[model samples]
Target: MDVSQVFDLNGKGAVEALALVEAALQEQRRDEEVKLWFKFDPPQPGGGETLFQPVGRRLRDAIKHGHAVRAMPAQGGGWIVRLAAKVR
Candidate 1:
């Protein structure tokens, strides 16, 4: 999927977000083909932040161990991700 339409975010921010997604995918084993989708906060700071958050170290380690995460845009401008085993 192009993934560009995944969110309304534009410019460098969008690129950064996409990069994070890719990194998340990479952490999940050496799989070459994977799919993911999700929505993140629009850069507002508060208790009501968006559901999606950055890929922390622990999650990254888990992914690197062989966990694939597929995310998609959910209601309330958040993200819904599916965690699965890696193929390779």
Candidate 2:
């Protein structure tokens, strides 16, 4: 089955981002395939890395662990995060 959803975290921060991503990854694990989006383009020129590093780190970890695919830059200021379900 294929699933699709969007997480519009425009003004929100890394904490919320991580939570949403984790939820998506968990949900994806229940299916064979899934598609998801997260609107957190980040990198507000000169913005402190500490402020956005968590989100980046979380995504990186997910990719490293094979829990998700990758975050692609969208036309809008966001990320089209593609996730893959974990194998049981």
Candidate 3:
């Protein structure tokens, strides 16, 4: 899913984005994972590591049941978020 369409790097936006992603995943019939892309603006004050923290927390908190979530830097200047069903 296009995270840009759902999130804007703000607290409220992060919540909304996670909701959308969770809903989408719930509706899917296949076992394929869901991936989201987010492009963040350059870090302000606290340096690079602080950039995606809030969104990352929200993503992790949104997971329920047996889903797994992870976020990592993308090739460009953004983050790649992934969500998948947990393996047994």
Candidate 4:
């Protein structure tokens, strides 16, 4: 499923957005990673790490123990994030 359709948790606040991400993780497929793309308004300098770190942490914490979460800036605008369980 597309991340937007599965996790469409658009909100005005960070806390609300994080909550949506957490909820989405619970419903995600266990065998495959979930990828998400976010676009920032006006974009940010230096990839917007400072703005996205907390959100990334929330995603990591929501996943299964030992699962991995990846977040990085996209070339043109916002961020790309992926969450997946670790291989045993």
| Model 1 per-residue lDDT tens digits across residues 36-85 | 44555444666453324543333444455656454445554545445565
Model 2 off-target regions past 4 Å? Answer: 1-3, 41-53
Error of 2 at 79 (Å): 1.5
lDDT tens per residue, model 3, 1-88? 4442323343335456556555654544445566666555646675435446665565566454345466666554455666675444
TM-score to true structure, per model: 0.36, 0.65, 0.45, 0.52
Worst 10 residues of 2 by lDDT: 47-56
Model 2 gets an lDDT of 0.64
TM-score of 2: 0.65
User: Candidate 4 has which clashing residue pairs, if any?
Assistant: none
Best by TM-score: 2
Candidate 1 segments whose C-alpha is farther than 4 A from its true place: 1-12, 29-39, 42-71
